[model samples]
Each structure stands twice: as structure tokens, then as C-alpha cells.
Target: MLSLVDSGSGTVVGRAEGEDIVLDVHTSGSGPALVLLHGAEGREANDAFIAALAERFTVIAPSHPGFGLSPRPDWCDSVEDLAYLYLEWLERQDWHDTMLVGLQFGGWVAAEMAVRDCSRLGRLTLVDPVGIKVGGREDRDISDVFAISRSELDARHYADPAAGPGDLSQASRDDVLHIARNEEALALYGWEPYLHNPRLQRWLHRIHVPTLVTWGAQDGVVSPDYGRAYADAIPGARFELVGEAGHRAQIEQPDTLAKLIAEHSA
Candidate 1:
């Protein structure tokens, strides 16, 4: 049985997927399925965004395999591996008409999955996604992107770094391990080409689903040029930018970001 925890203004339905994945899932409202994927430093806390997104669509927010209360398995290595795990998860849930929405690294993984096999996804929504690495644009690098203190990471990953999910003083050992595991996975998949496959970029045109690529005008993590590349790589993809918001524009500017997604998901 799953326990429901109140998030002050709302509730999060929590479920334990054994050692494989024990996560706090947030789902509210009702309609076609929308799966929310989180960035490296967050858990289902990203569900806060998903919950609001649920006002128009049925949301399914799951904590990553090794984040929050979820445990990392030995088999889970590459983003492709994780993507297949997600496919299996959807099958078990018996869900369909799915719109896969992901942020940061999660979004990049979603794109990878769609290009490889998009039989299940109805649409793809990626916000400030990171997959491809550009040449000669070495500002802050993904090689050490997640290799910093919690406070430093929070600042880098959020538009309003002050609104970090919560304080770190209260964080548990589990949380720390979870964070490290995600990096380990990133390192493994990102081995040679650094979390990106050039051929995968070539497959962007093969994605049949209507893809809406959104970015923040102030995204320091990735350049607008990279965003253009992403938009250009995918055939018929619509690209838009949210001003004043950083890498986490989806959370900082939910309504504006949500509007972009709804327009395409419609």
C-alpha cells in the first residue's frame, strides 16, 4: 500500500518499488497520462511541478531508480538502460496515450528513448535538456556539472536558487548516496562521448511524435545555440524560450512553461 503525504498545499502518493525503486509519486486531477521525469539533484519534489501540470493532464511522477527512497540496481547503467526500464514500468502500469515530459538530464534521456523506439510515447516535452556537448563553448562543463556541494549545485540547477527544494542540514545519508548514484550512471553512459551519441542526434528526425522543445533564455547550463541544435535536429520540432528563468524554467515559470506544453500536447 502507498502512503499519502501532504505537501502543505497538496498531497503526494508514495509507493515503494522494493529496492528497485521506492519513490514518492504525485498524481492529481485526471485525463490522458503525462509522465514527469526529474533532473539529477531532485526527486519527486519535481512532482510539485507535475502536480500543477496535472490540473490539465493526469500526471505520473516517479522518483528515479536511485533517487529519494529508490535504490540503484546493478543492471541500470546507461540512459538507454534506464529508458528501457521506464518502458517496462509503463507496461506494468498498463498506461497509454502517454506524453513523456522530462527536465535537464531526464529530458535528454527521454529524447534518447524516443529516437530509439517511440512506440509508446504520444508526445515529447523536454525543458532545458542536456544530451549533446558543443565544441569550443566550454563555460561550465557537464563533466563536473554535478560534482559540487549541495548548495552550489542548487544554485547552478535552479532559476531562483534560494527556493531550493529544502535545506541540506536535514538531508539523510540515503539522499547523498542517491545523488552519487545518479552521477555514476551519468559517468557510465557519458563514458566516451560525454552523455551524448552523435548517431542519436541523427535519429531525432525519426521521432514521429509531435515534439515541443522548450528552453529558458537564461539557461546557463546550456547555450541557446545548443537549444537551436536540439530544435534543428528533430524534424518539425517547435522551439520556444522562457525569459528570466534559468535551467529550471519549467519550475520557475510553470504557467508559461505549461502553456507551451499544452499547446503542443493538445
Candidate 2:
């Protein structure tokens, strides 16, 4: 069965294996499960939004392969590949009626998973997702985050510059290396499609589960319009905006975002 071990600290730690890949999974709280897919930066420990959600529902956050403590497997080189890996993991766990939440790149992965199958899955939430192109002509789609300086990128990611991961001058060597590694892994999975699956939009209609697409009202990475298009493509999907936040709502406005997620899933 699922070998989850509760550490008495309100968090449970475990590992899952599928397709020759292993995932370091962290879970907390006590009701239904909510699987959180981390963004390109990897997973965070004790994140505010995650803690908030833990109060009402069990939260399960897994680091994408090659992110955080998860090692990358050679066979996993695309977002689609990651999607399949996660699907296999979910099936292996025999989890049912679970809520799935994806943020940024994780959101893209979640979308892919839902499009493939919704069996045993309950609700879906995509936050500041970047998986489909919504730009035309002179307009730009998602911002080229890798193309900008770290400081500038942070500026666009948060409404308050100070709240961002400021200058890394004093950043620990390990922290610096971790950031580099995250970018490299992101490129491995998203470089070819440039962070989007060209055909995902067309396949979105296949998802018949309740879906919520949330965007930070001040998001500069992917505009609110792009988020709206994502919701519109999926029948009956609802799009909501979180104010005073940018790309990372969980970082800027965790509690509020958690409320939005909890209500939608409920």
C-alpha cells in the first residue's frame, strides 16, 4: 500500500515509484488529499498556502523530477513525459476522489494529466499556468523568464519587489546551484515547446472534471488574458483573480489563495 509515515509533526513523508522514477512526496493535515504540483523552482517546505490548505484538507506536494530533492530520470525529458509519470504514480498509490492543484509549470502538468484521464480525480486547479499559447500578431504570450535578469524577473513576479527573492549576492552556494539546476531541468522539459504544448488547448475539452483557473491580477509572467483563455477553452471552468499578487500567489498571498482553492474544491 502507500507507505506514508506521519512524523508527528503534522507532515507525512514518503516516496512513490513508477516508470523507473522516484518522487519525494510530502503530505500534511487530515481530510481529503490535494496533490500540489510545484513550479519550475521546485517545491517549498511549509509554504503558507500549503499550511492553510492543510487545515481543511490533506496536502500532498511532490517535487518534479530533477527539482528540489527529486532526481531526474533520463526518460523524463518533456512535460508530457512528466505528466505520464505522475499519472502512473497516482494509479500506483490507488488514490481516489483527490483534488489536484498545479502551479506554473505544475499547472501545465496538471492540465495534461486531466486531459488524459479524470478517473479517481475530484477537482482541478491551475494557478498562473503556462501550457498554451494565447498570443497573436504583435502581442506576446508568456514572458520569456529565462531571457531576463534575475532581479527583473523577480520584479515581474511580485507586486512588491522586496518580497521577491532579492539579489543573491549573499545567497548560499548551494542555493545558487539549486536555482541553476531548476532552470536546467525546466529547459529540459519545456525548452522545445517553449513552455507550452501546442495541442493542449484542443485537448482541454476532454477534461470533464470541475476546474478552476486562477491568475494573479498583477501577474506579469502570464497575463490575466492568457489565464482567461485557458479557462474559456475548458467547458464550465471558472477563472478567478487574486489581487495584490503576481506570478507566485502562494508566496505573496498564501492564505487568500488557499481560501480560493479550498472553496472551489469543496
Candidate 3:
């Protein structure tokens, strides 16, 4: 069983035998429960987006273990572990009919969770998610984010690179540290598989809840076609595109993304 304790720092510490997983969870607003799973960059970039979602439903956003202030447990390594951890957390909270939204890497985690069990989830939304290989061995469906230059990455990640977050040189010390931590954790979970699970596509059919897979119209990282394929694999899943946005739609076009999510969950 997982036990949660308030850490007095706006974060929740979850404990389970021999493992202490500290999750930095941010909660706001009131109504139906809506959980937002952030991208590899962590939750710092989604403040405006979360606030918008909060207007319609109570928003619960948590930094994945190893991101932000959450420390990665030695025994917990894979995305599947993260998925099960969140599932247990949800069960403990007794939240029913919850709307689960995931961005980028978090979307992958959410997908893994839904495939295993979505009884507590009423709806699912994936924005520019990366998981499951839809191509042959020689094909690269997702961009190599880790190997690319910052400028090249920004070019691929944003419809208009200038509109996205500026270079890391200009970021605050705290922001830089947060980003570094996120990158390290992301590499640990996704590097070996190159950001995809060879088996996830096979189990996507197990997700019974309504799912919406959204991609940026100009996404260079995963392409709109990849998004469509992802949506098609899941029974009854719908695919939509956000105009003038790239991989990180929540950051590049928060208002449009928020509107889409609100409508979908409604």
C-alpha cells in the first residue's frame, strides 16, 4: 500500500515499503479531478496551461519522480514503474471519473497506465506523445532530442522557435537546475529504448476509456502522421491537430490546447 504525507512545501511524499517516492504535486481550483502529466522538461513550463485548466476543473499536476524536487528511487527505473506509481496514488486518493492529460513524455507514461488499468480514469488526452514504434527497424519515427543541438531542437520543437523558451544561457539558475534534472531523468527512462516501447503498441487496444491524441500541425519532432497512427492504434481514439504549434503545444499554444482539453473532457 502507498501512503501519502504532506511535506508542507506544496508537495506530497508517497511512501511504500523500502521505497520513499516524493512527488512534487501542485493542486488548484475545484470541480472534477483533472490530472496533468508534464513533459520531459517537468512542470515549470505549464503554469499558464494548468491555470487555464483549473478554470474548468480542479487541476492536479505532479512532477514525475526524478524531476523537479522528486528524487528518483534506485529501484524505480522504467516508465512502467512511474505509471504504476501514479495508478496507486490515484487509487489511494479515491478519485473516480478523473480526466488524465499528458504532454510529451508524460503522455507515454499515461498511455502505459491506461493500457494496464483505466478504471479510475474517465478520459485520456495525449499531446505530442512519444511511445510505441510505428515504423520498421530502419525508420526513426521520433526525432533524437538528446543528440540534437539546442538550436536544431528548438527548430524541430516549435512552429516558431522565437516564440518558445529562449536559450538556456538566459535561464535562471533554478530553472537551469530543474531542466538539467529533468533531462537526466528522461534519459534514464527513455534512452535505452530510444523513447519508445517495442511492445506498447500491441497493448494499446487494452485502453477502454475515451482517448484524444492531439499533435501540433507543424510538429517536426514526431510529425502529424505519427500522431494519426498513434490515434488509430487505440480503439475509438480521436486525433486532432493544433495549428501554429509544434511538439510542446501546451507551451506554444496553451489557450488552444486548454480549449481542446476542456471540450474533450466536457
Candidate 4:
């Protein structure tokens, strides 16, 4: 496992390698390893969720390449590339059969990793994963979050916009830059297929490990129907809906989400 020093807030921040790519990772708690993959916005924003999870298990949250302060490798242009990179990182850390959690775009990464190879992963939790064309092009499976304004995007992601991240207009310069980098990275990875892998559904059968799939009841970005479709694709996966929440359950319902994860992992 990667050795980490506390960041003075019950979390440890550090960098680790994934082949040629360097990832900024935060770790806390002390128990079985629990690797967390953040969404397009990066790890900094999920401090509450991370801390809550850290209370029960070791939480290893990593910022995707090109997001936050992490440098993106030239070759890392797709989610598939990210999956392999994470696999390499896991092997280097010698972590096996550990709990794995993914949120939003991170959930897409977790699904890809779980299906590709589950030897290193234990229980798997996917929170509103968006990475497949569930319906025909005429039917909107996922919202065009990239095409919308910041306020609109927030509105779609949270039942109460005030509970979500601060508006970009009111953000600090550093926060704005970080968001720009995150959006650029999201475009590089998910723009073409529009947040999905064409063949992922067909390979869901490969994920035999225990899985929990959760979604926000009021998710406008990707409806609960889409979340149900994802759970149905996986064998023996359980599906749940958190009421009064939208796409970002971790933000709106951290305590409840963390409790679910803790119980499921147990």
C-alpha cells in the first residue's frame, strides 16, 4: 500500500504512479482498503463523504488524471485507458479483494475496472454510473451536462442547487481553474460516445462479485430508469434509490450513503 502522511484534517494527500501517469490520492482511516474514484469534479469536493467513509474503512480517493492538480498523460484519453492505469496502480500497491466505490464518472471507471478484472476488487458500489447508451438515440439516456450552463448543471445534479457546489461565478480563481481542467478531462474521456461505452452492457456478465448500485430518486442528469438498467445488467446486483437527492448523492446524503456502504461492505 502507498504510505501516506496526514494532511492535518484526518486525511492524507499524496501522489502515486499508474504506469506513466501520476495520480493525486487522499487516504484516511485504517481498515481494509477502500478505493474511491471521484467524478469529473475531482476529490477535494467530497471531503465530507470521504471523512464519513474513513470513519469505518481506509478510504483511498484518487483524482483522475488531468483533474485537480494531477497531470494527465498524453496517452490517457479514454476511460479504458483509466481502467488499465488503475489496475496497474492496484498491482503496484499489492492491494487485493478490497472494497471499491465509484461516483458519477468515477462509477463508470469502476464498472469498467470491475468487468475487465475483479481479482483485486472485493465489494463493488456504483453510484449512478453513466457509461452506456441504454436507449435509442431518439430517447435521451443521459443529459448533455457539457452543453449546459453551470447553474443548469447544478440544478440537474442536486434536488436543492444551494446544497451543491458553489456557483462558478462565485468561485475562487483556483476553483475555477480546477473546474476547467476537470471539464477538459471529462471531454477527452467521455465526449465522443457521450459518457458511455457501446459494448459495456454486453460484458456486465463478467462482473460476478457482489455489487450495490445506488441512485438519487430525483436525478435529472440520468434518470433512475437508467440506474435500474445498470443494476439489471449486473448479476446479483442490488439497486437502491436515495430519496430527496439528485445525481450527487454523496454530497446531498453523505451520512446515509456512507452508512449504506459501511453496511454493504460488512
Candidate 5:
């Protein structure tokens, strides 16, 4: 049985496990079920987005193993593993008419899941997702996020770099640790194939659920063109561009992104 405890912060923390793996899940609100998959920056980075989503739907957000306070099992390493794990978790929850939304890395995970089994999902939204290769072997569709300087990364990640996380020197200890953990986990999973699954593009057509792919209009990490390709790969998926935002559209424009998601899922 899954064990949930009150986190005293309006969110309930639950442990969802499959075999030896356990995921730290944060849940809140009440309405139709909406499972949110967070980006490489981890769960805390999407706090505002989650709160906005919670207002309309019961938000079930899980910290991928190795992110936040979740422990990563030795055998679990890739996004594919996370996809299967979350799929099992969804089955265990037995939620119907669920909306699955993925942001950045989490978007990749959600796509992987839907391509495998979308039986319980009613809708899917991928925001600035990175999981498929749409460019030639010599072309780079996604930017090298790690290689870039913090200033450069911020500029690429947020439409208004001034609005990005400023002056890390003032960050709390917990915040620093969370950031470090996120970076480590992201590199571990995305380093080899450079964030795109070699086979995911071939299987995207397997996803038949009503899908929406949203991208930051000014996204430099992965251009809007890449987002278009992502939408085109899935059957009947629509694409939209969130203006005045970069790669992290949910962070840059939570209300706008939330509205788009709410309308689509509704």
C-alpha cells in the first residue's frame, strides 16, 4: 500500500513504489485528476505552476527518483524507466479521465508513457519537451544547457532573464541542494543520448489521446520549430506557442500556461 503523510505545507507527500523503486509524490487540490510531470529543474521549480493547476484539478506531481527528496534506485537510470514506473503508479491509483501534463524533461516522460499505454489518460500536454530527434545527425535541435554559462542558460531558459532565479548566493541551503540534485540527475539520464531517445520518434504515433504541445514562443533551448515537429509526430496533436516566455514557459507565464492547459483538458 502507498503511504501518504501531510507535509504541513498544503501539499500531501506520498510514496509510490514499484519493486525497489519509490517516488516522492506531492498532491493537492480536488477535482478531475491531473498528473503533472516536472522538468529537469525538479519539483520545486514548478511550485507556482502546480498551485495554479491545483486550483482547477487534483494535482498529482511526482518527483522523479533522484529529484527532490526521492531516492533513486540503483537499477533505475533512464527516462524510459521513469515512464514505466509512472505508468504503474497511474494503474495503482486507478484514476479515470486523468489529464497528464509534462514540462520539459517530464514532458518526455509523459510522451513515453502515452506511447506505451494511454488507457487511463483522457488528455496529454507537452510543454517545451525534449525527447525526440527531429534534426539531422549534424544538426542540434536542443541547446547544450549544461555547457552554457548560468547567464547564458538563464537567457535561453527565460524570455526575460531578469526574471530568472537571480543571485544564487542568497538561495537557501535547501534550495541549493535541490538545484544540485536536479543537475546531477538530469546529466545522468540525458548525457549519453543527449536528451533524445533514439527510438522515441518512431513510436510517437502510438499515442492516440487528445494531445496539445505548447512551447515558449522565445524558447532558445529547443526552438518552436522543434515543438512543431513534436506535435506533428503524434496523431491529431495540436501545437500552441506561449508568448513572452522561453523554454520554461510554465515558470515564466504560469497563469497563461495554466489557462491553456485548463481549457484543453476541460
Candidate 6:
């Protein structure tokens, strides 16, 4: 079932970050540099979510090294490596006054980036972010939970049918299969003994930026316990539970998610 909707207008640029090919994405709307990172699903998975955000901010949403159309570099290993390359992108663009929003793995990217440099960042919001393993205290990593048939995709992504699944853009069968195949590769590269790096957790308290952590109330992917721990780990962080949603809270609850972001940025 193909759903018709308005795709964002933008220019895609292939920029070089050392040996890596970085995609320098520019899109509509105007404001500070709001960088968005998609979860393991793929960058395109969050296009509509980002487009809704692009209306109020100069959104700079990039595909991670391998995901989406961007060329994945060999040197990029840990999510920490990803953080460094993204900072390089900012330096290249000479951008400042930024807000960062991340989903799932992308949220980990935001957490990782904040620990590195919070000086340029104004606000941080994470939707079902995966940076550290919550250990049943609060959140559970979806990488540990997504072992089922393809049909389970709907229930896992969104609880509210009205808002539609996170992948509401309804990708072509071939495209959907192609992206799903790559997610396995992502899981292989990113999944570890633990859902996150122990070393990375130590750096969370160092972030002084005003942070907002959100999770789907029904997020079996990464349990709510994990989400609370994430918020508690960070300095001055507030965690919110987006009810009736699961891993893809923003995609399932875009309006609620957007309002939280707007409030945080404001």
C-alpha cells in the first residue's frame, strides 16, 4: 500500500570527510542548525519526521557512514568514531548554535556528540535513544528484541494506528527489503556484548546542555527503564514517556514528539 505525501525539497551534496564520503544535506525551513540522525532503520526512515521539523529549523539530517545513500567508510568503527566525523562536518560548514535530535542509534549519536562538545549545542532531544544498556532497570535495547518475522514490524514500530507506522512513507517492496537487509548488517556492526559502551556512559554526566529524553511507553524495543537511566545519567536531563508508542516514538507520535522538541529548543 503506497501512501501519497509531500516529500521535502532539498539539495543533496556529497562532501568528503577525509577518506569518507560525507553527505552534506541541506533542506527547507530556517533557523539554527538542527542536526537529525535516524535510527538503525535508515536515514530515509525519518524523512517525514525531519520534514515536519524542517519547517521551523534549518535541519541538517545526514545518513550515517553506511546507511542510506552515503558511502560507509571503513575507518568508522564505534559510534564514537561517528561522533568525530559529524563534528568534522560542522567544522567544515562553520556551523554554530545547533540543536541535535536523534532516534534509536541516532540518539546514541547525539549522546556521543554531546559528551564530545556541548559548547555549540543549545538543546538535545532523543527519541528511544540507544547509547547504554539499561539492564531492565528502565529501558531495553530493541536490538535484543527484534527477532521475529517481518509481520511483527507494525506492532513494534507504532501503537497508534492513526499516526501510522514510523515507515509511513510506505517504501517500495524492493526498497523496504533492501533497507531491512542492511539493518542486519547495522546490527552486526553496532550490536555488541552490551547495547552500549561502558566507557560512553561515563561521559554522559559531562554534558551540560539542557537535554530531553523521550521513550515510547510501550517501547519493548528499549524498555522504559533504560530510558530513565539515560536521562538520569545526563546532567539536567528530563525524561518524558510518550504513551501508546514503542521504539519509534517520534514516527508514531510526531506531533507529541515535535512539541517536546519545540519546548526543549525554546
lDDT of 1 by residue, 1-266 (tens): 12223344232222223433334565666888888887765554454576568788887776665554444456656777667777766766766668998887788778877877777888999888878655555643453564567666566666677755456557765655555565565566566566566567767888788888888786766766788788888888888888867787776777887777778788
| TM-score of candidate 4 on Cα atoms, chains taken together | 0.92
Residues 145-223 of candidate 3: C-alpha lDDT, one tens digit per residue: 8998888888888999985556989978787787778888889999979888899999999999999999999888898
Model 1 deviation from the true structure expressed as Cα RMSD, one decimal place: 5.7
Clashing pairs in 3: none
- What are the lDDT figures for the candidates, one per model? 0.69, 0.81, 0.87, 0.84, 0.86, 0.71
- The sequence of per-residue lDDT tens digits that candidate 5 reaches over residues 1-266 is 11222243222222344344555778898888999999887888888989999899999888887777777777779898888888877777777778999999999999999999999899999999999999999999999988988789889999999767766788777777787788888998899799989899999999999999999999989999999999999999999999999999999899999899999987
Instruction: Find the 10 residues in a row with the least total lDDT in model 6.
Output: 1-10
Best by TM-score: 3
Poorest 10 consecutive residues by lDDT, candidate 3: 1-10
lDDT of 2: 0.81
Q: How close is candidate 3 to the true structure, as a TM-score?
A: 0.94
Residues forming the 10-long window of minimal summed lDDT in candidate 2: 1-10
Clashes of 2: 0
TM-scores, one per candidate:
0.78, 0.90, 0.94, 0.92, 0.92, 0.83
The candidates, ranked best first by TM-score, are: 3, 5, 4, 2, 6, 1
Lowest-lDDT window of 10 residues in candidate 1? 1-10
RMSD of 5: 3.9
Better of 3 and 6 by TM-score: 3
Evaluate model 6: give its TM-score.
Answer: 0.83
